[model samples]
Target: MNSIIYGPVPSWRLGRSLGVDLLCAPGKTCSFDCVYCQLGRTTSATTERREFVSMARLTEELKEVRGINADYVTFSGTGEPTIASNLGQAIDLARSILHLPIAVLTNSSLISREDVRGDLAKADVVVAKLDAHSQELLRQVNRPMAGLMLSDIIAGIKLFKSKFTGKLCLQIMFIEANKNFAVEIAQVASCLLPDELQLNTPLRPCPVKPLPPPQMASIKGNFHNFRNVVTVYEAPRPEVKPLNLQETLRRRPKL
Candidate 1:
């Protein structure tokens, strides 16, 4: 079978994460043309969702993952996870067969929609992106789909905060363009009162050059009031044997 699932990739925050691609055919689809995207831009930007792959097929692949030891079962690959309308059903099915906690990485643009928020609520952890506090900066950094308003996105995040009881981690992808507005971004993050604020900069080659790592002393002095803040830079990879399907499954906990 052509693999619908890929990578027990090393994630700085989630440890060894097993990724589930809900959009794209192994590679395709996305909501934003992110400057720092590792997989490049979406050939077709869309909000529509379908069963990108059969649940039966995904379940079969997941059975292999069931033997791998991963810290998280992440809903992230080539694009935004929320764009998949069948996401809630997929999450339900995955939960039924997998014992690990689920994490969804979203751009936070669609979470304002009631249906999207309802679906995301099922995730154990929702890491939402908020790179810019102002509309202009939002446009520069994310280069989101046309008609996506920054104000509306913020409002959606606030709405999700009100209804979802799961852990919400605000991921701020700092770049040179938005570094000057760090204080303002921190203020905006304060309002959301996220469970955690993760400060990160582009580690991958970006369309635009990224800023130098934020001055830790300065950033700390400025944004310490907001909930727990954690800053990370890319860590050097350790050489290890590449894991095969059986080895990966052996490490994973039974559902």
Candidate 2:
């Protein structure tokens, strides 16, 4: 059977993270085709939600990783984890089976829907991606599905933050396109009131080159008002070996 669970992949933010892919479909399925995506451009881009992996299968996979040394069981893979309709159920199952703190990394595309917000609320930590502040920048950077507006996304995040008791971290990916607009994106992130702010760029192999440490430091300065801030360049990367190297690379290449 194709593995729905992969990694103990090393992460700067989550330490040794075990990844769970609900949408284990052919190629990458995502709502946004980000310019700096390491898995390359999005193969399938849509806003509709559906059940791709069954709970039974996820339970079986979770059982295999019960003793794995992972800091968090992350709901992320080749696609957006929020697009999975049964995400809340999956989180519950993973938590019950593995007893690890659940984390979900979202592109903040489908959060406008109340169902999606409810699903995301199950996680212990939600790393919401907010790369652009304006509609034009949204198009240039995120290239989201049709009818996805910047204003609606921001409002959705705000609403989710208001009710979520768990940690809400805002992740801002800075590149040449949006480097100069750090202050603008920072202003927007500040309004959302994220518990932690993560400034990141494309350090992995991708179409875009990662900005040097100096540039990233300059960008971090824009958010000096924020108490907790972390940058990709300065973060620690722990040593890890995946249970299945092939499976891990299938989801996150160059791991």
Candidate 3:
């Protein structure tokens, strides 16, 4: 599937990102089947943690990286990067091999596990999802795997943020379903105290549409309590191209 290493794509958050896929199996594998997922539905949704890809192979492929063309080495392709049993080791390998800042984009479903948070702690920037505060709406929007609770996820995120020394950005995606709870989500954000609050809406191939500019703008206002905030509607995307068609389709689109 050419899933080992792909893209030096223009990312809304990380700039030119070279994606490293962890769950590069035959098809999509993840813990959440979010309605607005660009990579489509999860073919194998699970709560287990195991090495889905070889750590040695990732190290070898990273050694073969050709140029100093990427801004960040991102663990983002395929599925939730934290689910990889070798994530902590993978981050270590990538760091020793490539002289680039590491970024991990996680769905935060696995954050309840202390090990998962520890693995993610290696990254320079961790973009964690907080789509909904209420469990019912979380279930509807994210459609997390069985045993994943909204309360646990929030608690884990809070714990991680408290210990994490790197940049922590809480990504809050707005849609029709969760737009009404902007204030509630902001309250949760107040507790986490992330370095930045990324206000986002879908901008990829998905059934759910991005909320209108004004609607999303209205939602952004509620998050003024945060020190810094950015939104997808007005944030300028880099003119450079992103991932190729295949890699673009394999990972979650621009957040």
Predicted model with the maximum lDDT: 2
Give the alpha carbon lDDT tens digit for every residue of 1-255 in model 1: 346565676666777777787764644477777777766666768766556777787788888767676777888766778888878877887777778888888988888788899889999999999999888888888888888888998999998998888899999877667777889998898888899887777665546665565554455556789757777654333332334555434222111
Per-residue lDDT of model 2, residues 110-222, tens digit only: 99899999999999999999999999999999889889999999999999999999999999999999999999998999999999999998888799988899999999999
TM-score of each: 0.88, 0.98, 0.94
How do these models rank on lDDT, best leading? 2, 3, 1
Model 2: weakest 10-residue lDDT segment is 246-255
Clashing pairs in 2: none
The top-ranked prediction according to TM-score is: 2
Query: Which candidate, 1 or 2, would have the higher lDDT against the true structure?
Result: 2
Worst 10 residues of 3 by lDDT: 246-255
Q: What is the lDDT of candidate 3?
A: 0.85
lDDT of each: 0.74, 0.91, 0.85
